[model samples]
Target: MLTRAQVDENDTVLITGASGGAESAAIQLAKARGARVLAVAGESKHESELDAGAQEVPIRGCPLQDQLGDNGVDVVIDLAGGPNWPELLNV
Candidate 1:
């Protein structure tokens, strides 16, 4: 969708719920592909959620919303899929 949406390489991407499951998979995949991915969540410290030397782990918590104005993410992948979903949009 990013390619079709015309998102560029410098664009920041916000991915919610980074602590587990499929969302974690997507985080790793997106980072591997070279996107600057921000893993948004209340907390993230699971076993595989972050590898030993992952370049940048997503910035966690609602406080990160402050970045909305300037850090401005280009795309958002809300994997939490519910109430947490709105944080990505409303932020």
Candidate 2:
């Protein structure tokens, strides 16, 4: 997924469902590639996500745009697809 997204050192990647196994792996990979990672998951999982190399773990329920302000990510890896999926596109 990272390859397809052309993630690179300059990119800021936003990853949803960041507490899951795949998402955790994604976070590490994105970080290893030198891209900054922002994870979105439950508050309970924030520490683990941060440990996995996410620079910031935003609160899951909060609007991604609000947390990120005008500095939107360069790549969005959306692993959680549901009602909020469309919101990711906007961000």
Off by over 4 Å in 1: 1-8, 44-61, 67-69, 84-86
How much is 15 displaced in model 1, in angstroms?
Answer: 0.6
Top candidate (TM-score): 2
Give the best candidate by lDDT.
2
Q: What is the lDDT of residue 12 in candidate 1?
A: 66
lDDT values, one for every candidate: 0.61, 0.91
Per-residue alpha-carbon lDDT of candidate 2 for residues 1-91, written as tens digits (9 for 90 to 100)? 8999899999999999898899999999999999999999999998999999999999999988899899888888889877987878887
lDDT of 1 by residue, 1-91 (tens): 5555455556666676777677777676666566776666444463345552233444565455665556667777777777656566664
Model 1: colliding residue pairs: 39-58
Please identify model 2 stretches exceeding 4 Å from their true place.
Answer: none
